[model samples]
Target: DTAVSQTPKYLVTQMGNDKSIKCEQNLGHDTMYWYKQDSKKFLKIMFSYNNKELIINETVPNRFSPKSPDKAHLNLHINSLELGDSAVYFCASSRHRAAGVNEKLFFGSGTQLSVL
Candidate 1:
């Protein structure tokens, strides 16, 4: 089984439509994250949640939201999906939030979102 998994590997939608990408991990991790990769391949951490609290990256827009009901899942919801929102979203999880060289982010295959 994959450590991290996301649904709808490909998403195609028109402008103004709302869509959600779901993520789940079975790695026994405490920290889960959502990242967005734009057309330029610039990857940015959009949200990071550790158990009960959420930490949003300052640069991320308000349209993006991350919800975690428990430690093993993190779901991403994009509001008013726009063309600029088109990108590959990645779900990842790590053992903990502590900064350690050995700490690794186990990522899902990724979801490709295209807004027309």
Candidate 2:
């Protein structure tokens, strides 16, 4: 079984459209994250949830939100998407250790979003 999985592997939509990517991990990890990779290949963390509670809220636009129904799932919702939002969105999960440290993350195959 796959450790992490996401739906809609490729998405193409026009500006101002709303979209969401669903993610789930079977690894039973406690922490999940949403990461975005811009065209230039810079990866930035948008949100982090640990045990179904918001932990790290990065400086992402308000239009983007991370929704987690449970510790095993974290979904990314984008409202009024814009051209600059076109990028690869990744879902990752890891076991957080003591002293605020975490283990290696197991990432899902990214979802490519193209805003026209």
lDDT of 1 by residue, 55-98 (tens): 65657777887889898999988889889999999999999988
Q: Give per-candidate clash totals.
A: 0, 0
TM-score of 2: 0.94
**CA lDDT of each candidate?**
0.90, 0.91
- Model 1 alpha-carbon miss at residue 77, Å: 0.6
TM-score for each candidate, following the candidate numbering: 0.95, 0.94
Question: Candidate 2, 30: how far from true, in Å?
Answer: 0.3
Q: Worst ten-residue run, lDDT, model 1? A: 52-61
TM-score of 1: 0.95
Q: Using lDDT, give the best candidate's number.
A: 2
Candidate 2 structure quality by residue, lDDT tens digits, 1-116: 99999988999999999999999999988999999999999999889999999988989899998899999999999999999999999999998723255469889999999999
